[model samples]
Target chain A: MNRVFITGMGVISAIGNSVAENQLGLLHGTCGITKGTRLSTRYSGLLPFGEIAANDEALKEILSVTDPGVTRTTLLALHACKEAIADAGLTGAQLLSPDTAFIGATTVGGMCLMDELYNDANNPANNSAFAPFYDCASVNMYLQKYYRLSGIVNTINTACSSSANAIMYGARLLRNGLANRVIVGGVDSLSRFTINGFNALHILSDEHCAPFDKDRKGLNLGEGAAFLVLEKEADTNGKKVYAALSGYCNSNDAYHPSSLSENGDGPFLAMNGALKMAGLGSTEIDFINAHGTGTENNDEVESRAMIRLFEEPPAFASTKSNTGHTLGASGAIEAVYSVLNLVNQEVYPALHFKEPILATRLTPVQVHTKKQVRHVMSNSFGFGGNCSSLIFSKAG
Target chain B: MFFIHQTSCISPQETFSNVKMDLLHVSVHNKLLAIEPAYTGVAVGVLRRMGKASRIGMGTAMRLIQEGAAPDGLIIGTANGGMEESIRFLKQIIEYHEDMLAPGSFVQSTANAIATQLSMLTKNKGYNITHVHKGLAFENAVIDTAMLLMENPGNTYLLGGVDEIASYNYIIEHTAGWYKKEYTSNQDLYKRNSAGTIAGEGAAMFLVNNKKEQAIAELTALTTLHSTDKELISGQLKAFLKKNVPSGESINLFLTGENGDARDADLVASCESAFGNETTVARFKHMCGEYPTASAFALWLACYLPIDQPLPEHMLKKQGTTNKNRTVLIYNYHKNVQHSFMLVTKFK
Candidate 1:
């Protein structure tokens, strides 16, 4: 059996632009959620968001991408991919090898430029360059084309669980002997398409999101990207191994398109299946990074799910409180956060939680604490009832 | 080994499990609309609210309900997923000035909605994923499902690829010169020798199981290449067929993605030359039109075309196929970028 280990992690969220910065923000309990300024939405003034501080042009400048017409989603992905490969110490030759795979996920591909697409679609004579990037696979395709990566590259769009599935699929690439190394993650930018859609669903929070809270109103929309480099344990000789991705599973609630079953059958099955895959008992999981989207239905259902899985419930927190719900990138971002805990043997607390949901009566870790974090679980549930869970363990 | 126990396709042609010769002509129009089945089972209320892409996918997935236990994993691939709903929702937001917007269209606009709907209908709470890579979408899903089956044997898997053709998407492709400048019929798709190919949409579902007894055709290998060089594609094809194809016993049938575009002639010619004259060549894109997942439709076609079925005059390129059909290969590529290969053998 091939043992997959996480060699590196890179993330850029509302909380921070790099892994270290993000970790510092997590430690200080700093929240990046605020009224949106970057996205061009009419409800931006009312809705809180964990939006990236930089615009597309500035982000491209930071990434040294001079090519015109590149979308913000692609820029965010490239930034994260660069950091991940560099952190993994992957050389240019290694990246060009057929043994390397790149799997990316994104909910807001080029739809971030919905206006451009609409205009271009309405007037074909416009010859809009953004039209080429309107497809959902644009970000991954751009990454693959830019890096000249010819391996088993794929783009996943299972809504929020998109990146978690990407990571899981990347691990399978190594486990199946299809590739020696894989860079897996996802990116999603704040787009009117999603904002209006989520707003229409009445789940966009007007204030800072309070995950796992009884009085939580809704979720703060966010935009970001995160990536992790995974390789076989045997292959990482003297490489900085962060953690072991021991378990991963994706299950669907099949009950609703945007909402989970009241009982969270999807999250339950995903969490249980992940633990089963890791060959660990629920008690062994020291902490959990809950999906807690801060939505009324999500918080309560996730709380009930935790109670059903953990006898006493682990010290869990929804990092979304800090970065809002990053959607497709949340899974990978939280996966990186979970690994940081395993590496440093500490856990961060969920923010803005005044009281627990009455049903589960469960409260998340409310303060930053240090402990011997052995195994951590992260959950990402997306629209279409697509639920995914991943368990990462401490590496020697 | 992964055997396709059951399969269904909602294609432009009347390709629902079995192929129909009717409506099997080249589509002159840019869009080749799918001919859907009147799927029973699953409530009409639930089906009515779903998007076209979701409905097509669910219809295909529902056909495999009686194959066995609930699938351990469900994977779907789509290049342009739920676009009708997406466009509708976006249009509503812009048209209504972002006021009084309904969430129904937004909820159904996601790429994985079909997978979620199927899971809910079947109560199968297992691994579910959706791959949305362009051109390589279906191959990506198949690769994931196949690799998972190798790791977890005996676990039945439902793998599918779905896409839809919308007016705006058609226009987008047309503007990009992805559609023919002059209208060409499906039969004359190969003869058009134009700059663009026709657009089509459909869904293909395969119940992949490890058991050979419950198999229609044993899938030997599925490989994809991300390169534009025809020589590289030809070289890789040779290596792939060498590993999967037996010595001396050449492939009896070749299903090529020869959507009539003079630009792709080099690739089509390269593939034709790679397989010796002994291999009988056939093409599928003309019948179903051209889409990212058209190769999946071609795959469904390859599964049954070798069972002593008379080849259509338009489908055949070279005759003289061996009577003892054993191996069939499906090769397809888009523009010059992504190339995919699938080998299916006659289930003995």
Candidate 2:
């Protein structure tokens, strides 16, 4: 079996615009959660979000995209994709290589352009530019067309676990000899559609979220994008390898639409399956990057699941406390964070935590501390009981 | 080879359960819907919250699983998912100015809902994924399933595609000239030259496994091309068939995606000469209508007609009916850009 290796990574989130800045923020326990400033929403002032401070115009200027019809989702995806390819030191020909696959995951593609969609849907004009950008695969298609990539290009939308599945799929392509290198990740931007959707579900937090805390209010919606360039171990002889993608698995709770079962069956199975694939035991998992959505249901259910799997449970923390729950981007974002954990030999603290949940009696790592991290399991659960767990190991 | 262990499809066609229908019954309106069954054993709480695609898709998936197809992974390719819910949510956004949007519609609006809903129903916590790439969506899922099966030989998958037509979207596509100007019944779709085909929606799922004992059909080859060059298309089609169907044994039947569109007519015209006069040629879109993932219905028909029963007289656009409909070739070219060729052979 071919071993999948993460050669390069790029991320743009509320906490930072690059992987270096995000690492600094994580080390200092800086929380990016705050009231929304850029989104044109009714609850922008009342609800807190991990919104990228830069506006759409700033992002466009940064990406040098002149296409006005390109949505923020596309812009964010472009930013991360460019950085990932650059970080991988991929040549121009490699970008257009048939052996290079690009898989992007997202729940909100051009749908983030909600206002434009409304006008186009009402009138049905053939000249409507927004119509072409409305499909969920629009952003990925834009990347493929601009780069002229002929490799296997795909888009995955399993809600929060979306990018995790994308990463897994990319690895499978490499394992199956379909591609030699895969640029796999996800991107989403703060928009009225996502905000309103989360608000309507009554899971939007008014203040900063505290994952696994007794008084955890709800999730603070965030927007960002992250991309990781994965190559097989054989292909990375001299290239800088960050970590090995040890194991990944996706599972569904089959319990509810918006919430998980009280027993946390989906999370448990995904985590267990990923570890089994990685050929590791619970005791071997040194640290866990818990999904920790900070919602009342997610924190309790996840904590109970952790307890069930890891008797005493490993030293785990939710970076959502630092970066806010990034929806579809959370999994890949956390995967990067877990890689950073193995590389830097440190554990980032979960912010705003005071007491443990009554049922599970589990508390996250309260403060930033140095640790000997080996295999880190990153969990991301999403709507419709979609749960995914990824295990990353230290590269030799 | 990836074999079809079991399958189910919810289409406007009279394919309820394992029953049979002899002929096509064209609907009065352009938009045709799947004749859904009464969903039983599903939790009422879950049912009420599901979008239309979720209900129909889960029902189809459950029926296949009941045939003892235990899938370790769920992969779905839905081009337009939960259209009604997305439309309602978008309308509310326009109506209420982005505030007070109903949570139900928003929850079900994501493209991932199709596969997630099925996984939730089965409680089979496995590899669940969804793809949305317009015309090439279902083919993408199938390609991925084949790759996954190749990587892990014994592993099976529930790979399928689902799409729905919402009224708002119907007006958008219909008014934009994606549908025909004249109201032609689906059965008579090919009689008149038109700009667009009638719109339809359906959900089709197949349990793809490596077990030859339970194989319904062998998915010999599935290839997707993104180029529009007709020369490349014909060349690739020949090479694809040569690899799967052999040189001497040409295709027994040609199940073409020949919707009423004139452009499509020009594309399918090559098949007439390419396969010679001995191959039976037919179309399934007349019954299911045209959509991005509409080729999925063609796959469902290929699963049945060649292996189980004969095609209806109305469906046989060209009569090259042979004694044994063993080698079935499914070809679809969408919007002149995406082309997919699938070769399915009867399991003997």
Candidate 3:
């Protein structure tokens, strides 16, 4: 089998602007979670979020987007894609080749724009003005138009697992000789729709989210985009390989729509499948980026899955406490962090943990520390019981 | 080659359980509406969380891969996924934009919820994919699955397609001339004198494998075209059949994308004329709603036809001798935007 390597990565998260900024934040244990600024809500003062410290106009200028009414989601995605393209040192001409493809995953493609447009009584425009932001075609069409990428461009919206699936597809494309290089990632912006949706479920935390805490409440919402340029190991020209995407799996719980199954069966199966693909065992995983949403249900179920899989649970943390739940972008953002961990040989602590949960007698790593980390696992779970786990290892 | 081991579809037509050639009946009009059963019995917890589309998708997917062990991969296709829920949320946003909106509806609005729900229900976590490319959505997913299976021959994959038009949104969109203004009844679907077909909803699934079996259909070759010309479509089909099938072996069944619109029906007619009366022709869009992955339901219909040999009245366009079902061709389009052709033969 051909080995898939991450040659370049780009990220725009609460931690910092670029990949290096995010890495620095992780190293210093700087939490990006703060009161919401971009999104207006009564919950703003109560609930903390991993919000990018830029308004829509400023973000547009940063991304150099000319369109006036582009969705915040697209703005975030273009920002990350630009950094990724530049980091890979690929020009628009290079990306236009038939051998190059774009696979993007997102839970909401341009719903943010639709939300704003739907309320626009002043614009009173027809479908032509809003046509570019209402459908799935616009998402890829705009990206391809901007980048001039003519090859296969597709979108995956598998909820929170969207980006992980995108990465999995990108790797498979390279491995199967379908494409030589691909850019895969996910993006999502906080919207009134998502905030209220979580509020209706009563899962939004009023205080800072505390994953795996004894008295954990719920998750804080976030928004960001992250992208990775994937290529065959032989195709890369010694661009410092942060990590190898060794193992990945997506699974259906078939248990419930909104809730995970008891005993963490879906996550266990996913982890087992990914490990099997990587030709490794539980012991090989050095650190884990838990999908600890601080929700009573998620942390409990995921912790049980972790304990059942490993003889000794790997030093793990739920970065969601620091970054907030970025929804669809969480998987890709956490994946970037996982690669950084593998490259930097350090593990960030699971902040705000006081005691272990009763159901699963597991305690997450409580403080940031340096370690001889070789392999890292990242987990992203979403509504409709979708669960995905990706394992990345230091490139040999 | 990644072969289709088994397939199943739960649509408006009587093509779900039976596959007898005679049981497959042709519709009298161009658009056929699905007769939905009570889904309360099929899905339990997932049903509560899903809208009409995801429930049908999950039900059909479970039926297709039930006989085999859990699949190592899952790929789903939908043109406008979770739009029913999204529309509902949109309405709420307009009604109560200042209030806290329900996150459940918001989360379910994303198209990927179908795959995610499938994963949570099945606990089969290998590789999950969801594609949304309008008319070519299902074909893109199928191609991806084929590529994945070709790379790793030992693994099994679940490929599924689903699309739904809920009543309120259906009526609202129909007012915009999305569906035929005249064809209101399901019984009058296949009549040739309609501008648009009635909207419908259904789901189909197939368990594709590299290992051959008795009930398998060898998916020999598949191609997609992005053109509207009848001549080009016919040429592509002819070339594909010529390259994939053995010499002198005529296509036994030609599954067409006859959606009752004058322009699209003419395209199907031109292709039928290219093949002549030698092959038995079939059309499924009348039974299933016109959506991106409507061809997915047609493909599932073709896979099951050779097994049970159903002669349902809704499936037949031109009757032929009910000899053992052989090569079946699925040619479908998404409103002239995307064209897909797939050839599948019953494995001896």
Q: In terms of TM-score, which candidate is strongest?
A: 1
Please write out the lDDT profile of model 2 over residues B1-348, one tens digit for every residue.
589877788888777575555757676677677778888778888788777778878888888777665788888988788767877787777688776667888888888887877776777777777888778788889878897788678888998888887676677677667788788888788887878888888899988888778587888887776666777677777777767765677787888888888766756776556786668888888888887888788888788775435568877877774645788899986666667888998774
Looking at model 3 chain A, which ten-residue stretch has the lowest summed lDDT?
A119-128
lDDT, model 2, position A109 = 86
CAPRI level of candidate 3: acceptable
- Supply DockQ values for each candidate: 0.81, 0.62, 0.37
Candidate 2 lDDT over residue span A1-396, tens digit each: 779999999998888999998999999998998985576778878889898888889988998989757888888888888888899998889888878888889888888877777777677754466666766788888898788786788888888898998898899889888899999999887778778888888888898998999988899988899999999999999999999999987788978778999989999999998999999989999999999989999999998898889888999999999888888788888988999999999999999999999989998998889989999999989887888899999988
Give the poorly placed runs of model 1, Cα more than 4 Å off.
B22-28, B321-324
DockQ score for candidate 1:
0.81
Tens digits of per-residue lDDT for model 1 on B1-348? 488888888888878856775447445456678887787887888878887889889888888775556788788888877878889998998899888899888888888887878888887777888899989999999899889889889798999988888667778778988788886777677777578888888888898888888578988898888888899898999898889877987998888998887889888888788787678888888777788877778877776565676577778888754744468899988656888999988773
Q: Is candidate 1 or candidate 2 better by DockQ?
A: 1
Model 3 TM: 0.84
lDDT rank, highest first?
Answer: 1, 2, 3
The deviation in Å at residue B300 for candidate 1 is 0.5
Best-fitting candidate, measured by DockQ? 1
Q: What is the lDDT of residue A85 in candidate 1?
A: 91
